[model samples]
Each structure stands twice: as C-alpha cells, then as structure tokens.
Target: MKNMSLVIGLIAGMLFGGGLAYSGMADPARVRGFLDIFGHWDPTLAFVMFGALLPMAGAWQIQKLMKRPFADVQFSLPDTKKIDRKLVIGAILFGAGWGISGLCPGPGFAGIALNPAPALTFVAALLLGMVAHKFST
Candidate 1:
C-alpha cells in the first residue's frame, strides 16, 4: 500500500511538472508577462488558472459526496475559517514574493528540472523563509 501510494504520488508529481512545463508556466519570464498588466500582458496564464480551477471545482463537489479519500483514512482539509492579521500579512507577503520572483512553491519546484540555477536559488530562499517563519512562530 505504501509503495502504491508512492507510485501514485510520483505519477501525480510528474503530471503536474509536465503540465507546468507544457503550459509555459515553468518559465519566470512567461509568468512575469502574465502579471504585467500594464505592458505586454499575457493572457495565457489566466486561461491556465481557469482551466485548473474548473477541474478543482468539480473535485471539491465530488469530495463532498465521498466519505473518505481512496488513498487516505480521512480527508485532510484546512480547519481554519478566521481571517486574522497573520493570515492577511502572510497573503500579502506571498503575493509580493510571487510578483517579484514570478515563481510560487509549485512552479518553483517544477522549475528545478526545467531551469535549475534560478529555481535552486528560489527554492533555497523559500526554504529559508519557511525556517524563519517556523522559528518566529
């Protein structure tokens, strides 16, 4: 069962990385273009976002009907509902980082294979940020 889970995870990761690469999202320049609303804005990322949301919306609906996930004993969902200062600050920070680097966690990881140097730098900074957050909390 553990091996099966590992296989499934590997396949999913590969698919996700492939999707990012194929969609051109793995490129920071492409992502920055999407965020460049004032000049040479790329609408491709919007389509990608919508495409991702469609399947996820359906999955959420499907999850509501399921007693438990097929691979898990129980559904592991976010329990937080409150919007506090920490949440707001974290969101602002996340947006700032994404805008500046044009690479969030998902794409950052995927970029490691596509473009190693920049991705490694981003990942290292991301890890440092995570560690800082852990210690601060």
Candidate 2:
C-alpha cells in the first residue's frame, strides 16, 4: 500500500512537472513578464491560474464531502481562521522571493529537468530556508 502511494505520488509529480513545462510556467522570464504590470505584461499566467483554480475549487468542495482521501489516509486540513503575525511575515517573504526570482517552490522543482543549474540553486536555498524555519520554530 505504501509503495502504491509512492507510485501514485511519483506519477502525479511527473504530470505536474510536465504540465508546468508545457504551459511555459517553468520559464522564469515568462513568470516575470506576468508579474510585470508596468512593463511588457503578459496575462497568460492569469488564465493558467484560473484554469487551475476551477478544478481546485471543485476538488475542495468534493473533499468536504469525503470522509477520507482516496488513499484512505486522514485528511490533513487547516483549522486556523486568524490572520496573525507569522502568516503576514511569511506572505511578505514569499512575495518578495517570488518577485525577485520568479520561481516559487513548484516552478523551481519543475524547472530542474529543463534548466538545472539555477533551479538547483533555488531548490537548495528553499530547502535551507525550510530547515532554518524548522529549527527556529
């Protein structure tokens, strides 16, 4: 069962990475163009986000109806409703990193197979940050 779960996860990750590359999301330049509202702006990212969200919204609704996930594992859901200092600071840091590098965690990993060097650096920094946060908290 654990092996099946791992296989499923691997397949899902491959599909996700392939989709990112195919959709041009793996390209930092494309992402930067999307973020640049004052410069040569591109709106394709907005459409991509919308397309992804539609199914996600439906999935959330379905998840609410389900007792457990398909894997029979307990659904780990967020219980927080309050917007606190940590959340605000985290959001700011995340936005700054995204704006600067044009590569968030998902895109960073997806880009590894395409452009390895920069992607590896970003992933390494990301993992370091995660470790730092773990130790700090």
**TM-scores of all candidate predictions against the true structure:** 0.93, 0.93
Cα shift from native, residue 100, model 1 (Å)? 1.1
lDDT of each residue in 72-99, candidate 1, tens digit only: 6788899989999999999999989999
> Which regions of candidate 1 deviate over 4 angstroms?
none
Listed per model in order, the count of residue pairs whose N, CA or C atoms clash below 3 Å is 0, 0
Distance from true location, Cα of 114 in model 2, Å? 0.7
Best by lDDT: 1
Q: Cα miss at 61, model 1 (Å)?
A: 1.3
Residue 57 lDDT, candidate 2, scale 0-100: 97
> What are the Cα lDDT values of the candidates?
0.92, 0.90
